[model samples]
Target: MGRHSRKGAEAIRPDAAAADPAGRPDVPRPSGGRRRRQGPVPPADGYTPFQDAPQVRGGHPEQREPGGGWGTGPQPRHETTGGQQRSYAYGSAPGAPDQDAAREQAVARQVSAQQAAQHAADGRTARQPAADPGAMPGPRREFVDAFDADPPTPVGTPEARSGAGAAGPPVEPEEAPDGEPAERREAKGGKGRTFTGIAAAAVTTVLAVVVAGQVAEDSAGRGAVARAAGVDRDGSEGASRSDARPTPEHAVTRAPEVKPLSYGEKMAQPYPIAADLKATGKFEAVPGLAKAPGKGQKYRYRIDVEKGLSLDAGLFAEAVQKTLNDDRSWAHNGAMTFERISSGSPDFVITLASPGTTGEWCAKSGLDTTIDNVSCDSAATDRVMINAYRWAQGSATFGPKLLLPYRQMLINHEVGHRLGYNHVSCRTPGALAPVMQQQTKSLDIDGIKCKPNPWVHPGS
Candidate 1:
């Protein structure tokens, strides 16, 4: 039979190597009189204790129960010597005393020398006091024992070196030739930095001044320059804030004064016209109004003139208003009032025209005023016509002596007809005639003669 054949007891389980890491198939278990269970044989080359054996990473052995039959061989290496312990990992072989111990002692000696030298240098410096002289730490334990195990995890790297070096004494500052600190010697370069800063500040100030001058020139413009040079827009210096202004009296212009005519002058100055001069049929109303002067049943009347009449229309208007509104006339004792208007439909239009125009207008209402060349109230229409010839000349009855009363009586007699009154006669002979009497042609009626009257209530 071939030597490689397995017995029934050799089950070739996955944990066979864990039961016996030595890979010695013929070796017996420590149990009494029983053949040892074998593990799979290992390759001759690249053989290691942990390969195919149940072990932890980093070359550490797994803990096994005491009831297992695998404790007879040498124990795999752990992190210790016969009586010493180490914090580093993965060193040379276990129990090899000479080279590993000698190398560790040399490393400890070199670290201790470096710490002693640093302590001596700290003592000689005057600027730095020795730190905690009583509790001064000895040579660092980490650096002294850094190489004792050489574990798979690295040690004494730059990070480990800094942590281990922190417990040591401080290094000394470099000294100047005069025993002053090297930092004091370095202050010579600070003077250059300060000079550079001052020069930059001066440049900044000069630039700021230049910018301000440009801004002022732009803001002031040519007008400000001209003012500062004492010159005006005409290039002359004559006008200034201190120049005197013209006086109020000389600066202002006064209108010429006019004197108004008295009542006598307006009534006496007559405008002459022919007794038979006909004109254009068109009429123009005077443009004004005189409001009633009393609280009574008011009658509004208008003044209209034939287009070519030569008499004073203003005088005629004034005469009619004064005669009617008088206390002795239609408005006596505020019984009634009369207002004259120039527009809209009035109660009556007192019109002045030539005798021919008067005849023409009166004929429209079927009246025969042409027989005596007198005036009439065209009652069916809006006009009460007065003869302009008689207005300009005095009648023979009233004469020039009472020319004003004759004019007033003429307006009243005709306008009274417009007020709904018929011709009335004076009952008393030689007394004032009733204003409704036909005083313009004659004052005689039924052989009774009356003086001229111009008012409804003459005594008032």
Candidate 2:
């Protein structure tokens, strides 16, 4: 029996040696091929069985007996550490303390250096880098530093920098022998100042353009107002403020006598009698009238009286003309005609009369006069050819009734005939008498005076 037991132990010893080269005490040898129970085992020398065991993934113990009395001896060699088991790389050992301690000392040195740098920077002015993080170095940073150190002064100020000033571009500051900061030179290079120059030029151009446009607009407005007001008779001066002008109301207040025609006034008023009669727009009459040809194209008075009149050749003829033109109704109705005609010598022909002669003539003819009666055609002609002996205005029996108004009426009536207006029967009973009515034979019992034909407008 002793011999068989010895042979069996020898066979197991090789197997155990192969399975656990370190002879780990946690594993126990079974009694037979039937296997030993798997369990926690008490170790000799108080060494913990699991103190450095291969780690179980879940760090828990599997159910088993202390002595290896189990189904499988140490589990298959291919088996992985279960949740209850722990493991280690087959031959690796713990690192030496000396190497680890040396690494810790190096880390402490790095930390101390960083803290010292931060403390040194805490009191000084922070340096402003021209380049932010990841910026390139050289001229870009130098220029930025120069600009920060010196800024341009305000323009037009006495404290302003020169056109070529200290803020221009990079200039190295002078240094002391010991490397201390020395006084800086005025920055001189205009190079790399292109951006500033372009910006300044653009601003100047924009301002100049705006100013020029304002000036042009102001000048144009003033010119237009001056033309509209026309050349001042008194030759008044105007205000010179750039941003303001005399309003229309202000300009008008200064000159009451010189009435400026408004657009509305001009539009509402009628056209003048003759556009050129008064070059200066003044309408006063002149003396020393001249003789005119008989052509009706011009304002030449042509009249022919029947022979045998008692009136003075000139005075009577003049009176006849003056009376007819005075009546407003006659003038408005265009009772006078300016037709052209050839001559026959008789009384008088007034020429080159002003444009308002029709009105002037009416006023003149109303004057009282003494003259013999004459058989004259009652009419106002552009030209007057009267017979001194034929008419005999005052000498006749019924001649006294032919007052200035009546004579004027007669003249206007005849002129109406020449103007292509025919005599017609009166439309209204006891209405005013028309200048065209025949009043030579009967007295006017109805108190009728000249009235116009409502259908036609009147004018010279």
Candidate 3:
């Protein structure tokens, strides 16, 4: 048995040696009947070796000796572990460049360039010089020439180029020497001056038009006044006829003959009273005659009575001659004289006719006689047609107390028409009625009553 056990032990020894693959001679092996636990091989110096001693944990790789031992020394940095090297930057790890940081740097460079351009445009000096001398030139003649040769592209609008975008400060326009924006001042002053000129021109035109209208109105008014005053608009007297009369060759040499009579003798009553006169529609010339005793132009006249009337034509002729030769007659003041003509065409004819004939003659003469019985002087026929009814019976307006004066007024009034006199009224109440007044009708005019008058020249 002892021999068999020794041979078995030898065989186990050979198998153990074969299992030791490291071929370490000093290493101890397990001798129990079980197999050895699997483990790292020990060194021949009897020391255990550390595995992957220089390794990174939460931060940088731990410091270690060159022979893979723990030590307290600065460690060498690497871009990558057992791989391609990569560049590193601040706040970034190795193996790849910091794309986000590089992008930020590019944006910052663009912003700085924009700031420098803005400073130059605003006529200010930049604080910092350009980082790259070749990339950007300094402010010099050559740089200015180059810039001028290749001008920058123009912006679409002034607002966009002014840097007033959503993230930039607003730019302001330059001002003129007049303390206002150049463009704003020009717009305001130019428009204001133009408007002022237009307004002034309009006012001047209006004033001229008003003045012209007033001048025309004044001219028309003057013409109307001239016509109303019985004067020609051209400033000349409108005489009824030219003063041309055929006179005797001895008229200048001959002394006027006159027969003067007292007032009582002039007013003497004649035969065949007016009340006894018949109403006649026809007239006959008086036989009596007279000559003016004044040295001036002489006016010839004649008197006639209705043929069927009982009035004496000679007596009526005498009364007319006496009245015309009075100092208060139209011939007063040496302006003219009167002479009675018994025959031929006299300058004026004074006739006595009935009311019907008086109206007929008045109508034919274009005188208004329908309203009341009146005497009229026919300028065209040179006839003074005295109404016989008014002559013989007198007017109801003038009672018997004023019958004589009323007769004188009637003669003067009718004869005044032959002298180019127009109808007039008393200027005031109780005043003398003008000789041209129709006193045979009434002494009242336009709410004013006047006293009776008989002479052409009342003051005389």
Candidate 4:
């Protein structure tokens, strides 16, 4: 039995030497191809099993089984070394270190710190904290202080640098004379203010030219307006006459020759009177003269009839007085006043005469009465003559229905002539003829037809 046991021990020795390159006599050998349970063994001097070593990653020691293998060892406990507490995980070796991994980690950390410093200098990020807390922050703080103290440079411009190996004090950039930004001057090609001033001056000049043109046009317009309002006395266009003129003669001694007229010829006629009227060719004044009721220039007038006239003088005078005193008359609104005077030398005379006598009297006043039976307000004779022929026979232009209104119009027309009004034509067709229009001659004149109107104020 002793010899057999010695041979079995000697036979397992080679297997154990083959399993472990380093000679270890404490390792139990397996019997019948099964592993054996053994008691915990102390590490050899300067050597430890791979399963008992510590593991490290990124400078921090990790709690892991050594060599990634499981072990049933005594639980580790806290220990104090160099006054610092250290903890070891279960199944870790007590005296083994991975020097190559630690050295490689140290080299990687150094390369990372150098890259971080370079990034900080290039302004990519803020400076990183040192791996060792006790390391001084002097160089980083100094760089930050210098950067904060420097004056800010304008964007899009290079920062001003100091000399080769020395850092100088920060300098403030000079301002432009106009207090404008350097970038703004560069953007506008250095002509911003000059261009603005030129544009403003151009706008002012344009406004001045427009204003001058308006003033010139207004001056010319005023001159034209003034000229258009002026009129002359000889029935011709002329300039304004603000000066007074001499009084006209009241009568004329010589009369122009009369051109004979045939019957049925159209003559501009006067107020109509009865056919059986008689005349004596001498004047007799209308009686019962009184001041007319109005508020304007007073004009005393006399109504005269020929001595041989068969007409009722009292009736004629009454009709004339009523017509002139009407509300719509030319004498209304205080424009003028008229009264009949039997004794005094009147302002003018209204005479009812025969056709032959009317021609002689109108000719003496420089009117062309030879054209036949027409009335006239002659400035030379100061007389408003009503032809008896037209008084008996109304004008061919007016129908019998308009005879009475025509008589009133005749009275207003001759009176208007004496009031310094010249003849005017109708302005609009179908409108009332103005008092100054020669309505008795023809209501349709200059291609404008008008209705007969006896009163000057048609609305009134």
The Cα local distance difference test for each model comes to 0.63, 0.34, 0.57, 0.57
Q: Write the per-residue lDDT of candidate 4 for residues 1-460, one digit (tens) a residue.
A: 0001223343333346656778654354333432343333333243333443332335333343222221211223233322222333343333333122332333354345444444444452245454466432233334443432313432221112112112321111122334554234333422333344345544655777677789989988876765676643344667445336544577445687886643222122233555444455788788887678887788888988877665557766766776777778877777877788887788889887876677778888788754746788767896799876665566666665556666777788888788888988888999988888876678898889988787888797
Off by over 4 Å in 2: 1-299, 304-310, 327-330, 333-402, 442-460
lDDT for each residue of candidate 3 in 335-440, tens digit (9 for 90 to 100): 7778898798898888887666667778787886646766788766878888766665567667766666667777778877887888898879998888788777
lDDT of 1 by residue, 1-460 (tens): 0012234443343455766788544343343332333433333343334322323356545543322231111112333222222122122233232232333333454456544544443343345455576442333334323323122312423122333324331111233334554334333323333344445544655777677778878867877878876787787984665457665887678787787887656775556788778988788999888988889999999998989876778888989998888888778889888998988889888899888888988999999887777889897788999988888886888877777777877877787788889988888899988888888778888889988887788887
Q: Which is the winner by lDDT between candidate 1 and candidate 4? A: 1
Candidate order by TM-score, highest to lowest? 1, 3, 4, 2
Q: Which stretches of candidate 1 lie over 4 Å from their true place?
A: 1-260
- In model 4, which range of ten residues has the least summed lDDT? 156-165
The local distance difference test score of model 4 is 0.57
Q: Among all windows of ten consecutive residues in candidate 3, which has the lowest summed lDDT? A: 1-10
Clashing pairs in 1: 89-150, 89-151, 90-150, 90-151, 91-149
TM-score of each: 0.43, 0.22, 0.40, 0.39
TM-score winner: 1
Clashes found in each candidate (C-alpha, N, C closer than 3 A): 5, 54, 0, 8
